[model samples]
Each structure stands twice: as structure tokens, then as C-alpha cells.
Target chain A: MIKVQQKDFNYSLEVAALSEGNHDVGGVCAFSGLVRDLVGDKHIDYMTLEHYPGMTEKCLAEIEAEAHHRWPLEKTLIIHRYGRLEPGDQIVLVAVSSVHREAAFDACRFLIDFLKTNAPFWKLECTGGDSKWVTAKDTDTQACDRWLNGDKKE
Target chain B: MKILYFSWVRDRIDLGNEEIVLPENVTTVEQLVNWLQSKGDGYASAFADLSMIRVAVNQEHVKLGHPIGENDEVAFFPPVTGG
Candidate 1:
């Protein structure tokens, strides 16, 4: 499942839902991304996330499907929030369930990595008096590429 | 055809989306981008650097050489920076 929303999500509820009704699953990995308070040396008061209305959902679904194809995950969930958010607010969540821990761990990491590059979302960081659009870091793109080359580094 | 812009591209272009009728010869994304650059100052500056921009046809990422059609929706934006 994949969700893109303006409202905040419940982490415990979502993790439990992923782990529920599955006795055979030995591990469920969940990763949550938070808005950082600083961009380099500047303190970010808040951030406004913007996304292409119809395209964002389609891109996220494609990422989720690719994760399932690459790993042995029994279930997967991705939830991302948009609109204005505080420094400590939750930005995204990726949870994966599998019979073993390796698949769950690897797939959960892969989902977040791909989401950073593949999803059509943009972030604007606001300071006290000014704001700027965040650009994609070279490192982030390289992280996503590593997976495509079959180089998994945990 | 519909064209959409996002992020800094939208801010620079000062417009989000618009509908246009093609000339029936614009076959690839590169040709359409070149045509848009000639429309006005906003588009010219917004698309000043082709390397810094990314294009998508029908909501999927595509290169400049990707083929486009009259009914397709094409979007232009900067590289993604969200998770």
C-alpha cells in the first residue's frame, strides 16, 4: 500500500497494521523520516512540501511495485506527507513485512532510497526571513543507483 | 496537449500548467522544449539549463529524445528532492 497525504500519520498504528494477521512473518522493518532542523548551517524554521497532484501518486506506486519485485516482502506500506511541516514533524514512513529479517530490512531501506529520487515531490526550506527550494543531492541519486547495480550495502 | 511545471520551474515560469495545440510535427520532447523556450521570457529563463531540468511524459520520467504525442501530458521540473 502507498499513501500521500497532507495529514500526519500514526506510526504505531501503521506498524501494527503491517505486522497484524501474519504469524509466519518473523520481522517487520519500519523506517520513519523526520524533517531536520538545519540545512547546512542555517536553521530551518519549517518546510513546505509540494508535489504534482496526479503524478506523485503514480510515481510512488511504481516505486512500491519495484520494491516487491526486488525483494521477498510479504507486505509493504509507504506513507508520505505534504504541505507545511515543522522541523520535527514526520515526513515519510516505510514499513515492510517478511518471513525473515533480511528481506524486510533490505526492502524497507530500498523503498526510502528510491522514494527520495523517483517521487515527484519538492521541498522548500524556510528560515526566519527567507526561503529556498531544496535541490537533489548527488549522494541521494547515487544511493538509488547502487541498488540498480545490485550492490546492496546495509 | 498539456504542459505542467513544478517547484522552482513553476515559480520562475510564474505559471503552473497550460493547454496547447501542437503543429503535428513536434514528435519528441526536445523539440517541444525548444518551442516552449521561444514562447516568452518566463519559459526561456525557466528552461535555460536543460541539464538541470527533468521531463516527464504522461507522469513518467523521460529523456529529451523521448517521443511525445498530441494528447499526452508533459511536465517539466527540477530534480526531485523529497522522501
Candidate 2:
């Protein structure tokens, strides 16, 4: 499942919904990303996330499909929030469930790594009445490359 | 073709989306960018640094040499910063 929403989500509720009818699932891995209060002492007051209405969902669905193709995942969920958010607010959640712990862990990692560079979402940081659009870092591209270099299964 | 821009790319170009008939010579993404730069000052400035931008042909990331067609949707934006 993939969700793109402007409202906040309850972590517990989302997880419960994922494992509701699953008896085969032995382990589930969940990752939550939060907005930081400071970006190298800049004192971030808030951050805004923007995405293309139709294209963002399409990109995420592709990524999720790729994850399932590579791993034996019983269930997976991706929830990403757009619009204005303050410090300590949750930005995204990636959860994976599998019968084995290894599949759950690896699939969870792959989902986040791919989403960082592949998804079409932009972030703007505000501090002290000024805001700046964050640029994509080369390090992020490098992180995504690890999975594609040789470990790709499909 | 439909051209779309996002993030600061849209801010610099001053528009989010526009539909244009691709010239006969603009058969690739690289050619399309150069053609857009020639149309107006906003496009020229927005696409001043080609390496700083990323392109997606029909919602999938592609290189500058990727082929484009009249019916395709081409989007331009800064490198993705989302998780």
C-alpha cells in the first residue's frame, strides 16, 4: 500500500492495519522519518514538502512494486506527508512485513534508499523568517546506488 | 508534448506546466532543453545549468539523450530530496 496525504497519521494505527489479518507474517520492520529542529544549527522553524499530484503517486507505486519483486514481503506500506510541518513532526513511514526477519529488514532498507532519490518530492526549510529549498545531495544518490550496483535481484 | 516543472525549477521558470508542440528538430531531451531556453528569458535562466536539473519522460527519470515524442509528458525539476 502507498499513501500520500497532507494530514498526519497514527503510527500504531497504521501498523495495526498492516498486520491485521496476517498470520503468516513473523516479523515486521517499521521506519519513521521525522523533521529535525536544527539543520546544522540553523534553527529550523518548520519545513514544507511538495510533490507532483499525479506523478508522485505513480513513482511511489513503481518503487513499491520493485520492492515486492525483489523480496518475499507479505505486506508493505508507504505513507508520506506533504504540506507544511513543524519540528518533531513525522514526515514519512516505510513498513515491511515478512515471514523472515532478513527479508523484512532488507526490504525496509531498500524501500527507503530507493525512495530518497527516485521519488519526486521536494523539501523547503524555514528558519528565522527565511526559507530555502533543499538541494539533492550526491551522498543520497550514492546511497541509492549500493542496491543497484550488483545486489539487484530483478 | 506537455512540459512540467517542479520545486525551484517551477519558481525560476515562473510556471508549473505548459503544453507545446515540439519542433521537428527537438527529438531528444537535451534538444528540448535547449529549445526551451531559446523561447524566453525565464526558460533560459531556469535551465542555465543543465547539470543541476533532472528530467523525467513520462514520470520516469531519463538521461539527456533519451528520446521524446509529441505525445509524451516531459517534466523538469531539481534532483529529488524526498524520502
For DockQ, the strongest prediction is 1
Q: After superposition, which runs of candidate 1 have C-alpha atoms over 4 Å from their true positions?
A: none
lDDT string, candidate 1, A30-113, tens digits: 999999998778899999999988888999899999888887778899999999999999999999999899999999999999
Indicate the TM-score of model 2. 0.95
Q: What is the number of backbone collisions in each predicted candidate, taken in the order shown?
A: 0, 0
lDDT tens digits, residue span B1-83, model 2: 89999999899889999999999999999999999998888899889999889999988889999999999999999998887
User: lDDT tens string, model 1, B3-30?
Assistant: 9999999998899999999867789999
Error at A83, model 1, angstroms:
0.5
**Evaluated on chain B only, what is the TM-score of candidate 1?**
0.96
Error of 1 at B50 (Å): 0.6
Native-referenced DockQ of model 1: 0.93
